[model samples]
Target: MSLVKNLLVSISCTTYNHEDYVTDAIESFLMQKTNFDFEILIHDDASTDGTSSIIKEFEEKYPDIIKPIYQTENQHLKGIKASGINVKRAKGKYLAVCEGDDYWTDPYKLQKQVDYMESHPECSLCVHAGYVVSASNKEIQRYSRPNKINKIYTAEEIIEFGGGLFLTNSMLYRTELDRNRPGFFEKAPVGDYPLAINLALQGTVYYMDELMSAYRVGDSGSWTVSSFSTIDNKIKHFDQISIMLNRINQYTNLQYQHVITRTKKRIQFYLLVEQEKFKEALKEEFKFIYSEFGYKDRARMFLQGYFPGILMSLITIKRKLNL
Candidate 1:
């Protein structure tokens, strides 16, 4: 067992075949210059690539600051399971998360969130805006443009926006709240949204408008990646959404109606596509379309139902050509 320090924060970083970007993630945490004590708990889930080697190098260099939970066999899709195990081992008041594939860009990111949470005891979770970077580490999309500061958001607003209020790399939460509820990440293909929702249900959610991290997109390791790019995967995605909605329904004090309605529309759209009922699906989707989206998206969904297969293909071709 490692010597216990008066650490107030513990960053739980889970990695699998992230050799290309793991070094950046570790350096980001190590560069933090705060007055309070903190440590990092790293889990390398038996990655076949050089990810384990990178973690070993960091552990050897900073043995006291970086605690390693290295596994010998591949854990595969059980990455979240392994992460939960490491979280249980963490000894800190707060648990800040930054997966190995993603990294924080600001040195004061930890300090900012810690200070806010310390002053506001009513809040249980803190998150910040982030930018989407390509696999090659180039900036692609800004998460929340035209603004860069912290903003407090309510649970109702988060639920209305489809429950993606915070990214995994930009999250910090109380450890005790998570310890009381085990298997928090067991149900979904990903755990970020579920974790945030659970935390929001307990206390207020604070949002930092600053871009503190760069999320890597277009990576094959991501859950959103299309394996077969077939209708089956689309249908499966909707099914998973349904399961998430059902789970949310079990808990009280949550604005679940909006989530349920949006999920139902998504499922209807994919099912219609699968059953060749595009017209009916479009008519159903119109009822759920939020005003926030642009005209092109609404028109596209509407056209998907009205046009025949041949015309739709031509529209797709034309759009691609224009792009």
Candidate 2:
């Protein structure tokens, strides 16, 4: 691991039962064209699908660059977050993320991000656009930032977007800002959003309008897949989001109160719909209108509840229109 000296970046790649996809992920990291040294902190959360074997092979081949963490048991199943574990172990100036199911497309991704961060020292995070392709690669779409490239964003700009502006896999952050996260992280659901918000609070975040990564959709081994595979799992997901947002509110001290409340109402609507509780979902529809939701979402719930025939007809027309 002699090449680990003066590491400029640390790539955190967390995997579980990703035997079919881990190699592509590792190869992407190895192909990066960066001037400075970097290390890969890949964590295998005790996969039963022989994903660990592939990781071991790569580690053997690149002993100096690929550092693998093999968990004895399924840490995610046991409520242990692999991202948190990897972050604690990563000792680099900047942090890059590439989950096992996702891979980088551009070899110059790291070099470009590093160059930006080096020149613009005030920014805490740099994010780029990515292509979202189906598992079979038949369907592809681009996920991009709302603003133009090289646009700097403050904490308020991030929160006001409601849903985040960029995808999880297309990000690089200052390790120092993320290293000391608040205690609320224990209740956090997902790593990307909360971590982005945390960094934005400390400093500005930049969005580069470049497509450097490809995110795979419908990954059966993803945490959302493993956890939210059933109706009960849907309940847990929404509840966890509530806990996470509450913790975030506590840390931010109600600065984003209205947005949090609106989010809660939105989740409440989805929770009811997932459980097929139409009556309850209708109730939440009214709750959202008074709070923050626009006319489109409001009209959707009304038609689905009051005029099923019209809603069906409208949905059919939209499908035919393909707009």
Candidate 3:
């Protein structure tokens, strides 16, 4: 019998054209040293590359622990449809996510997270800081959590710090909560942020200040690196958050507005970048700033516009020179 038969901690790994890195990701999970039980669910989304073969190799070696799902036909669908398929089939009390392009650095990552969750009933979700590495696993930057970890973050806090939170690769949450709410990952651009936000609403979100995973960057396969300036991409991204806010209309109006304000600020920032209109961009960004964000953010946006281009240039140069 499988050790994970009783304890259901499913590691759901999604892969697509990550032939170079999928093997490492699977191997990392297989190497985890846990007292409890866990299973590896590898979902190959019709990778038209050597990704399938890599997964097959792992499956052959560890057939009992590793469960591989290889799609024969390439499902061109993005977002929830493609990724959610794997998550829906997961059979674990808790789900741990690690995409094919990323891998866990600490072998005890699952054990530590599961232990914390099991002890702390109030924590619905647990995440750890991760190192941002290049495609070759060279550390590009380190993402660390704030000194604060036990505090609950509002929707606004999450939206503003979404980039820092990273993706599901560094996350572990209750499985029943996700399975029951199938629409969790149905959002666009990606559903990790919104899903975490919703989960936070249910209970407290705990952050383990350890660097447990290595987030491989420079992957063209990621949505953030993809072309998001197009109208269709913007619309899809906007629609997802809008739908999420609508779903939780009864929760708190202020929270919904916080999400909206954050979204608008991001849209404005992107527009400014794409349009190359720093002045207009500053104005658009200022519109979202209110008493909620305090005078600091407002002052920053104002300075972004008021500062002369040459001054901004000098500051940028100074930073580069200092570095």
- lDDT of model number 1: 0.69
lDDT against the true structure, each candidate: 0.69, 0.73, 0.66
- Provide C-alpha RMSD values for all models, in order: 6.0, 5.7, 5.9
Error of 2 at 28 (Å): 0.6
RMSD of candidate 2 to the true fold?
5.7
Query: Over 4 Å off in model 2, which ranges?
Result: 138-150, 157-164, 230-232, 270-323
Model 1 misplaced stretches (Cα beyond 4 Å): 1-4, 76-80, 144-149, 160-163, 182-185, 226-230, 253-255, 266-278, 295-323
Candidate 1 weakest ten by summed lDDT: 299-308
Predicted structure 2, TM vs. truth? 0.80
**Better model by lDDT: candidate 1 vs candidate 2:** 2
The candidate maximizing lDDT is 2
Q: Native-vs-model 3 lDDT?
A: 0.66
Error of 2 at 314 (Å): 10
User: Candidate 3 regions off by >4 Å?
Assistant: 1-3, 76-80, 144-152, 182-187, 228-255, 284-323
Worst 10 residues of 2 by lDDT: 301-310
Error of 1 at 11 (Å): 0.6
Give the alpha carbon lDDT tens digit for every residue of 1-323 in model 2. 35567789999999988888888889999999877899999999888898899999999898989999999988876767788888898888999998997888899999998899899888889888777776655267435444444678677645534234666777898888877778666557767767777888888788887888887766675665566667677677668867877877888889888777766765665555555565555462434333332234434433322222344444433354342
**TM-score of candidate 3 versus the correct structure, residues matched by position:** 0.78
- Put down candidate 3 lDDT per residue, 1-323, tens digits, no spaces: 25455656989888889998887898888888887777788888888989999889888877777888888876646333554666687777888989888889899999898998899888788888677777865656535443334344554555545434444687898877766543433543456766777677667677777778887766676655563436466556556655665554434556566565565565455445344555554453444432223233322332232221333433343354342
Worst 10 residues of 3 by lDDT: 299-308
